[model samples]
Target: MVIDRRSVQRAALVVLPLVLFVAARAVSAVGDGPLQNGNFEDSPDQSQMSGSVVAGEHAISGWKTSGHIELVCSGQKQGDMVLTVPDGAQALRLGAGASIEQQISGLTQGSYYSLTFAASRTCSQDETLSVTAAPAPSGAGSPAPAQTGELPMQTVYTSIGWDSYSWAFRAEGAGLMSVVITHNCGQEEDPACGPIVDAFAIKALHDQPPDQAAADNNMLRNGGFEEGPYIPPGSPWGVLVPPVDEDPVSPLPGWKVMAYKKSVRYVDSAHFAVPRGARAVELVSGVEAALLQEVDTTVEGSWYRLEFSAGDAANGCASSSDGSSSSGMKLKAYAGTSETTVDIDFRGAGGSNRGKIEFRAAASPTRVVFVSLGYHTKSDNSGTLCGPVVDDVSLVPIPPPYARRLLL
Candidate 1:
């Protein structure tokens, strides 16, 4: 075959562009950010013992310690309990006053980034972890540091083992940014009582403001009850056995518990089946306990759908049919002024069912409430206190009339 040099050059030109395009896509998928050694697999020295890294030390590549931070290896421990790393072979342990930070350059100004990581409690009690991203320190000639919004601090409990968490933030001015993860637990005699963090990752989100993103997406926070307060030992949920006259506060985040009378409210996980996530909330002790939240609709007169999973908490609690006092349990959900109720039979305990309701937003902010009715009888003669389990609650705004017409 006779080969033409000019024809060969033209074919090479066509294939070169395709190769470059694929390479560019591969680079983008890997992400260009400052987070390095996110899995904690890279250490200056891979030691089996729990090693302490002080502030200004470079024990972990691309990360700096702010106080006395410990590098915990998998299956290592400081006390009687063995510390299990959430991901990879190593994890960073933050005590009462320790923190770890990483600074990355080349961020676009006004862009959004979603930070995610896994956290687990090292001690038997609960601990709080705070993570933030801000403008890195710059020279005098550099642009002034951009104002950064505070991310909500996460309170992790012992019941939540190796759970992943996420926070979104925006870059004020795109120069260099620093991401810091700190332990905010109170001082205690045992320094090992804190949160162990691993598997850190950051991805560039849209350019929209964080508040706008949240409002446009889902108006409900912790709707799945995954972010419930710490559950104690031997209890399925965060058990609040208040006096018969005093109302106990809701242990789940972003939800309020209003009991008409003193009763027990359970932030459930680990004991019963949860419809979604690792936890669910149950109203166990009171005659009625209501879980309520005020969700911002962002647009008045807008149609929104409220969806949730409900079931009876069958933690061996005897139902009314079990020959105990009072009728069986029920779940009442109120979106704005519209209400829907589901009867929970003791025979159907531990079974999850889905329910939803649509309502028009009369006001910009709408009230969503879920109430538990009836009393639960104890299987062990501990008295009736069972309630319905509520999980996977979500509120999504429906399109306006004009938008619906356009879609049609």
Candidate 2:
């Protein structure tokens, strides 16, 4: 008829923590609801023609469209050819000077929100899309104040197919905000001439200390070069042969090919050996075939570390004496205005080589560039070009010594 007080205390210690953890998770899930129909899968009106959503009417249930907008479904007609939705069964076809707007609620003031989406060119050779979010109008009866601190406009070129993009902005002084996606392409006679948008999403970033957030979040997008608009015939792998020119602005999704001289091979573990992930970029085109990415830094004036793996492709195409092939590759890394170069030589074929660089961000946004500077000369007179392989690239902000001690 007696109870053990120690046993009761032990049960309480375990049960109390479990209950608290479950409650915390439930609260987090409630806050994770979608801000809009980001995938554009809901189409109440089965219409494909332009201006299907009448003026002052909601398009696709949760969005309001201005000017001309079409809810394009798969297998729909766009002028003379059939149009296919990129992300889902349905997508928004924005006409020239057209826009789609939605109001996001339940946001925390002074918190940061990240917006992401997929966009592609539909009718034109190239298209630019701008996304803006600001505090909602004060009231239905009162005039709204001037808006400030809009995110930078993003331009997407469609030749590479559908590309994914992300941007972050801070919410100031309001719990509600309005998000607008506008097509900024020039006017054309065809109604289908605009950008195709799909899979839009907005999420509030977790409340973490500045230094911790920087350390946890990667500043570079697609640093591994895994996400690209197109998947080559050797899926997850693509080859960019010599004389194939690519724009330096955006050679692939979230990457730029700065100086492509010969051929560069995109390798994936699925098709070929890779240093990390499903894909890695190989310098098969010889020297000057470089890749770079520019990303906004959350922590300015703070030291950040660049880490990556480099090695030779060992494809037996590189030229060398004694009938053996060697990959003599050099990598040049630039962080903002400061620059450094490292020579990479594979001790043997497919040897593991690692490299690291540390730099401070001098500005709010920083440019991190990697260029190939070495080429292998041919001995067999095959005229084939070969160079080093680079993969698993990452840039992470380094916390100060004092902060590290505090965390420990």
Candidate 3:
């Protein structure tokens, strides 16, 4: 055994690289962008299921389930209600402490990633869903801290029962990461009560810091609503960005949803009539829904003009058969301490009207906020709240001459 030490060393060197190469290929094979079987359309085997309840942790394809998890079919009847699946023909219902998770690979360390999923409450109005992401079990170091966010499902922002929501977190480590969605509702009387979840997808968010260079003179980043989380294909209802206070990192960069219980709907041109670019934010929650951004100004107390486009997403909000909405939409724009309201009359189709407001900065970084003034619903009588779409936001300093004249 003591002979040929040099041969042994050479063998070790050759085998090490081969092992590393194979390991790298295995990691890349997972294809980190899309979550496998995210829509829950892949049904479990009959042996693994007792009726709709899945028995084992590995029963669901491409996922690990725990506690009481059930596969729900679209239009499944329960008493007088029919369950609606948000994506595809099937969805998952987590009961009590139950959760479903899958490990995603190809993540870049220190980069931000956002999870976009469609969910709706069931059984009780107080139902909430908790989403958490942490580095997968590894022998290296202690692993990064887990990021979690509890979403309140009491508010339904779409005509359908389900709404697509986005949650963001920063990846502290590369390699594989585990993403789990659990039902937070702990109703002992009915352990089956939980939220229906579907359409799980993730998007890597590019850095769009407030001070980042803009495409135009607009001080705000992503002002055109071009950069955002991935929208599940064919999702007519846009993704809802939860309040900034709850999620801190928004899927829609450079902007924050102000209300704790409200969200701003991020719509696409394919789904909703976007005013500008390929995307826009629809203020669907009336006054509860507000978007805010802070941008640096040239000088403190200097006048600045906040210009933006506001219009209907052409979602049939209060529409009449004659081709026009019955009511107009109003948006209140706030620049620093001063504010102004803009009213855009609906003209049946999707279109935008330009509006501007001049206000003193009061400080170098002024807070810009947009709040929908009135409540609106689709003309089809779906009872879904719909409102004006805001896009192409720009803030620039006003010349002294124009400022003085406007002041007078």
Candidate 4:
């Protein structure tokens, strides 16, 4: 058969973005704003980081810096100060100011980087700051290739206190880095004397391939399970009705009776419903309960809970009772879409005790109800109904029919 060229091209077009996503690691880093760091070396105290702004005086602060940064002011327009990160993380970010001075060493033999300043106060609409490393390029003497990305943050003049701003920056070329955070405080300050600067940290992302960069933001300090899936805070629970019933169960309720015989028995009958999106059904047995026999759905038109007795634990298909539980009753769950009719079977082994057998459906029915808790002897004598015991039966909605429930 001849293959269609257009089809192949379309498929490639769909997959091209995914292929390029492999380079997601090629992003830039950020540093605490100048309000906290005068020279990025030590950690800045967010509390002590505060101070009032004078009309023309720029109050800057920052910590965890290997470089220097300046601050910004409101009410007037000013230039910026470019921060320099000599080597590893050119740990440098700016507040409100203009590029004033930059001194980076070892760049002639390696790479270098710098950070741009954030917007000033009164620019409430401005959310974050941006920084880029202008590559002194062409020759091999370029310190490291500068990272090209934006820091998604902003901290201008607030009504009362100050908001902290910081980001992480990275350099590839191994050399001394130069950085300067440009700042321009408003030329007009009224009564405030302290513009607070918050604290920040520089935890290294792994030295592994850059592809893991985004995921690195969420890795645990101890290295365990991956970050959460960001499920909604209010995602609701599931819905299942008409529980299973069994004789000789533990903790007998006022509504149901105990098992009549030790040889084989069933439950007091139950009324249950299967909400949309259920996945699997459960059948619990006592130690005495034999392998599930004839564990089939309810004869109530649509399918219901599975039925099992002491005798039918063998092949969980349809089988006749052989008098002895050795050949105990054998039943099966009809795996099919009420409309699709896909045949699936459940056994004593497939979730016989704690596990569940899968079931499927086609339409998004409002409910696939069931009558849970109907079974027989777990064994000849083992799981006999003595004291209050427990037996369960639940309807498992397979894929298409699967949906979660929401609480009011």
- Maximum-TM-score candidate: 3
Candidate 4 residue-wise lDDT, 132-162, digit = tens: 3333343677455454333222321111222
lDDT of 3 at 162: 86
* Whole-model lDDT, model 1: 0.62
Query: How high is the lDDT of residue 72 in model 3?
Result: 94
Error of 4 at 345 (Å): 39
Ranking by lDDT: 3, 1, 2, 4
Model 4 TM-score? Answer: 0.24
Flag regions of model 4 displaced more than 4 Å. Answer: 1-124, 133-144, 152-161, 182-201, 207-408
TM-score-superior candidate, 1 or 2: 1
> Per-residue lDDT tens digits of candidate 2, residues 188-285?
67754777777776555543244643664766666666653233232322434122233221324456555422335555566455677666776653
TM-score of each: 0.53, 0.52, 0.88, 0.24
Clashing pairs in 3: none
Which is superior by TM-score, 1 or 3?
Answer: 3
Residues 1-408 of candidate 3 have per-residue lDDT tens digits of 567989989999999999999998875554324578888888888899999999978988899999888899999976888989987899998898889999887777777788899898777777788889898878878988898887778888766788988988776676578898888884546888788888888888875455555545667778888888888777788888888675567788788888867788888999888878898999888888789998864478688888999887887875332345447778889888888888777743678888788887778778899998877777777777788889988887788998999778
lDDT of 2 at 370: 68
